[model samples]
Target: MNDDRATSTRSETPEAILHGGDLHAVSGRYPDAPQPWIDLSTGINAVPYPVPEIPPSAWQRLPAKSEERILLTAAAARYRVASRDTIVAAPGTQALLQSLPRLRPRSTVAVLAPTYEEHALCWRRCGHQVHLVDDADALAHADIAVVVNPNNPTGRLLPRDVLVRLAAAQRRRDGLLIVDEAFVDLYPANASLAADLPPATIVLRSFGKVYGLAGVRLGFAISSADIATRLRGELGPWAVSGPALAVGTAALADDAWLAQTGARLARDGQRIEALLENAGCAVIGITPLFRLIASPIAAGIADRLACHGIHVRRFPAQPTWLRFGLPSHEGDWERLAQALGSSS
Candidate 1:
């Protein structure tokens, strides 16, 4: 999607951010709200990195392997990746998440919990022994371990040295450490395994969250040369479309945009913290793209916010927690503020 593209502003309409899962499914409960939802659902960037106009030819031909090379080169530089030999570009991290398990033999896999659900789901679907653990030591006896850095929902940062040590332990057991750094672009200072990766460690990066280009479906895996070759050989050729490759290459090359966007998101995150605090909710964890608020009335607030045509994320595991993404426009902020003010 374009940088300026946004989800539905009407909670009743239920955009991609909500789909069949949340607000729309409960719209009947909030029939009095206005149309055009002030959606803050998901952790996607409200102000996306600017995308360059695509040439018509990008859509006309099959993507050449040469185009994939350019995209990988740009990604390597942008990510400060250890080496080009370590990177494997895929359609999206979801695709990588699903396929990575099958690349190796089935064995016990431990995934950090209170994180993205896909890691465990994919591993289980692939017939691996799946264990959910809260700490890194949980991977000790497993053949594989999955972690989301600057963790989702909590904004928890596990130190790199700590993870490197864990990777060494996993390595000794003939296991691999997979780190998902999907939200790391906005917080590079927060412990990342991307640069100078340790032995037997693989890092996953998603292009959609920071760039606001989820529709383009671009993501990458940074791993050993052997693993990279296996993934490439497995996916075959033209795994990424020509237009996505063209757009992603241009986006990754724009260092100025990335820097500016990081600063802007930091500021917006602070604003969200204040907004939630003023709304009588405790802002527990926040990243550049979103904030997690704890409120006794969280579920009620979510339903009320939907009544005001604003959609924010609510976690089933943490019944008293709500997550709010950055609101790009002044009007969007005002609407959210008004909704929070009057909802109770």
Candidate 2:
């Protein structure tokens, strides 16, 4: 891997920050590509959780307080959060991300660099002085610190102990530590800080990524009761839809399905890594959801794949890097392999 080409400071404008799953935009760019494009752009699970049937009432009426409670209870258990009261359910983690900055006064925010772009973007947009720092030790100087474990696009997983110490440092100054555990579901016991949360820390868990149900729009924030309550107040009544509540509740309780999916994703991760390596790409990041690779012709490779109707993630800042999510079906695997062979 070319470290010089891969290392870039967080200097992208909000408009320049691109995310995956934008088929419409990609289609516009590659108008003559194939029909039914194979989207391996986002880190989202290619195979989503089987959604349960929604009751008629869930569609007809507003979500009841009882329903919300039940969803939170299930999420609390699924995330190993000690108290339901400490978890605040929302439409999605994106909503919580936007709302979090508003809850506090404008202050210095330090984000572990080259992780998710949204954390720094949100804080900066909310009038905070945002610094994109290179290490956890640098984060200690800021009023709020954000860390994305098993980080997006790179698959960097910070150990629980490292995060605990960072949180402790933030606590000493009454600062907050926000840990985004969006991809930690695959190895929760090894990486998640949800079970034993540190003081002045807030952990955001994404239901859509691991569950493969991004459309359901269910996510939770685990923190102190006071912080949770404040977030709940910010998100008014029925912040999450009725169908989302039902689906989240049912999915979180299905431990068997979760285990099976995790195992499958693990196998798929290895399969993709091997495939990339054979294509002469150096795999740098490995998570159950996606793989990041480095190649001198990464941009050309992405375009070639796009022409074949296979969309992988390309970073503007890191031109040598490309990130690919797992192919959902056997046909997708074949298509990707063919595309990679042709691109090389």
Candidate 3:
């Protein structure tokens, strides 16, 4: 699509899009639904890492520079990035996403779509001409290109080499490439773009998804030193809280917990897919944290699940599709199965 046409189509003020994990909103819609809704909407890990005890000072005092450095160091090691200086911590990846567009002049932005809507919304809010494109090749045509690796909902994973080539193209034109690796934690280390980052490329990682600590709101941006410095300046000092620093530092270093959780999530992922298939929904995507399925009655099924106090994600743009995050416990699994059987 042409930039002028795309720019004209976007509203001057973008509307906020619906996101998962808002139990209150769902409850309000389905007031008669059972108590304690099972929220299988976001791709966050069902089993969260055990939070380590925080020092009293973490709450008592403002975050110290040294504490932030420690967290960054741990994140750097975990992401396999060589230098901590190339990383910048934020309150969450959402914060970084909002700020990134302001870093550059208003220009053409291409987002790989039917994925997270926030990327397009954020860029458009910053006065960029944003277009949604399904083709990775179309990304080269934009001044800034945004891709979600192991993409949300669809679980689409672009090869590292393909992204590298796109990044290189953007670099040659003094453009930028933004890769959101929010769901890549469960994939092999080599699947990430954080390691061996290309020039003019920024990688956004969400600590919340893998660790299941979305409330703590910790995330990072991996980029060239200059870009990292620029992002740091934009976020200002102590952008991350003291408790978040403490929790993130401890959690990122726990290699054993990561391995164990990855295995469990993998098994649960398969189980959910099987359940959906048996319920007559075609499973289309497989990421360790969630599954995407298609059924002609997807909206009806979502409403049925909501009535049963089980909330799964449904897309307005694609009424045939639904996304299911892993259920945390046996009861949740059983509840979901029964709901699906009835919905079918």
lDDT of 3 by residue, 18-95 (tens): 888888988899999987899999888878989999999999989999999999999999999999999999999999
Query: Clashing residue pairs in candidate 3, if any?
Result: none
Scored against the true structure, residue 201 in model 1 reaches a CA lDDT of 93
The whole-model C-alpha lDDT of candidate 3 against the native structure comes to 0.90
CA displacement after TM-score superposition, residue 139 of candidate 2 (Å): 0.7
Tens-digit per-residue lDDT, 1-344, candidate 1: 22122111112221122221255655666677788766687788878766788888789989988888899999999888857778999998989998898898767788888787778777766666677898777767688988898788788878898889889998898889999998888665446777788999999999988998887899999999999999888777889998899889999999898889988887777777777888899988777788888998999899888988888887776899888888888888888888888321
In model 3, which regions exceed 4 Å deviation?
Answer: 1-13, 342-344
Error of 1 at 281 (Å): 1.1
Report residue 96 deviation for candidate 1 (angstroms).
Answer: 0.4
Q: Candidate order by lDDT, highest to lowest?
A: 3, 2, 1
The Cα local distance difference test for each model comes to: 0.81, 0.89, 0.90
Tell me which of candidates 2 and 3 scores higher on TM-score: 3
Model 2, 147-207: lDDT tens per residue? 9987887888888888889999999998999999999997868689899999999999999
**Highest TM-score: which candidate?**
3
Off by over 4 Å in 2: 1-12, 342-344
